[model samples]
Target: MKLGDVAKLLGGRLEGDKNFEIEGVSSVENPKPKTLVFCSSKRDVERVKDIKQVALVVHTPVQDANCVVVEDVKYAMAMFLRIFYPEEHPSGVSEKAYIGEEVIIGEGVYIAPFTYIGNKVVIGNHVKIYPFSYIGDQCLIGDETVIFSGVHIYPRCVIGKRVRIHSGAVIGADGFGYYIGKEGITKLHHIGSVVIEDDVEIGANTTIDRALIDRTIIGRGTKIDNLVMIGHNCKIGENNIFVSQVGLAGSVKTGKNVVLAGQVGVADHVSIGDNVQVVAKSGVANDLEANGTYGANLPSIEWSRWKRIYLYLLKLPELFKKGS
Candidate 1:
């Protein structure tokens, strides 16, 4: 695609050579000729000034390079990649796949080899269940969803449309619930299910547990990264982003657009409000209010307070010695 055509498609203002033929998209740090890069900030614009590769810049226009000024560079990049580098899904059901009794598979679905579809399961149109995937009994997989290899969906779970569950992901597994009895500890059985709403993307090795009662719900457009653990009865709101290694204990509730960064741990029954941003390695023990950037230990403080608290902690030992 030509630079001018790309800019027109992205609704961006074209600068420099409009006729430059673009081959692929890449990052500015690794500038490749004929590839389109995205400059997300003014600093990125300055960094890509001397870069010869084509760029998609936000707000700022590069003087020397062939650039397209877009309102949102990241969104444009995602659109461009979707158009240019569309994923190739496997076609047709494999003969080696095992379909159990009363299974209802829709048209255009692909069931790969070694996949097991349990009894009374309903797989929607164009859904792809890859090799070694296990769809348990009474599960409902929505249209256009892709379940990658080694994925296990436990019985009665519901996966919504346009959802992408990557390899080794386990949905609706029994949560870590136990009861104290006179005899000893008794294992609490999970009687509920998991409901993953539309446009959600669950990464590899991520486990979403089944609730003790009702459902463990993942709201629409939520993106959960690899190795994340969402415990039983958690209610995750729409468009939330949980980074890798983030762990949510049982019954944790998050409002819309919440972001929990890498390694952030939320204790059981904690409530995270809408538009909240928890920084990396945060330990959230108490409830968080909306529209603030929080970080550090339990009862996550605002970013500014966290910085001050962190600085004061370094001088604590010296202050204690002087007082003694």
Candidate 2:
């Protein structure tokens, strides 16, 4: 593709030589010859100027190099990659797979080997389910969904369009609800379901618990990373990016585009507003408003500070001795 063609495809303004041909896409730091590079920041512009490349996908015009300016650099990158490597959809139940009675499978569905799909389930078009996947009864999966190996989805769960549930992700496991009893603790039954909205991608080993009385709702375009624990009755909103090992306690409500970094822990019943960025390892103990960014505290204190605090605290012994 040529530099002008890339600009036209991404709906951007090209302020460069249209004659240059790009063989492929590459990073700005180490540019491959005749490859498209991206410069989304002014700092990146200086970083990529001298490197040999065909053109740059940028928010501003490159000082002396070929430039294509777009409204959003990241969106343009996604679009360009989509165009560059177009996906070919696959279909049909595998010879090694097994299907239960009254099952409703849609067009262009690929059910792989050793998989079990239960009755009265509506699986939508272009759905690719890999090996050992188990979909329980009355589940509704929307179009273009992809279920990877060893995924166990419980009954009555609603998985929406373009949703990708990766390997070993257990959807709708029974929630941890117990009460004090005469003999011991008794388990409360979980009767509610999980509703995963459109364009949500769940990473491997993630477990979303079923609710005790109501539903657990994951909103649109939320990408949850591996090992995330989403408890019952939690409502997560649109386009949120949850990194690995983030744990949301029960009944937590979050607004749109909230970013939860790695190992972030949310307390129960708390409400977080839109565009709030929770940094890595931060413990969210209260509510957060929209567009808020918090920097977490460092655990390791300076040695002198620690010693001084320790010595100040040890004056209790001196006070006791003086009193005696």
Top candidate, metric TM-score: 1
Q: Please, what are the lDDT tens digits per residue for candidate 1 over residues 1-324?
A: 888998899999998888898888767676677878787887776665457755555667766777888888889888988888899887798999999999998989999999999999999999999999999999999999999999999999999999999999999999999999898999998999999999999999999999999999999999999999999999999999999999999999999999999999999999999999999998999999999999985566799989999899999999999999
Q: Write the per-residue lDDT of candidate 2 for residues 1-324, one digit (tens) a residue.
A: 788888888999988688789899878677778888877888776776454465888887766688889999989999988988887656789888878788888888999889999989899988999999999999999999999999999999999999999999999998878899897999889999999999999999999998888899999999999999999999999999999999999999999999999999999999999999998999998999899996485577999999998887899889889999
- Tell me which residue pairs clash in candidate 1: none
- Per-candidate local distance difference test: 0.92, 0.90
Q: Give RMSD to native, each candidate.
A: 4.7, 3.7
List the candidates' TM-scores in order.
Answer: 0.89, 0.88
Candidate 1, residue 297: how far the Cα is off, in Å? 4.8
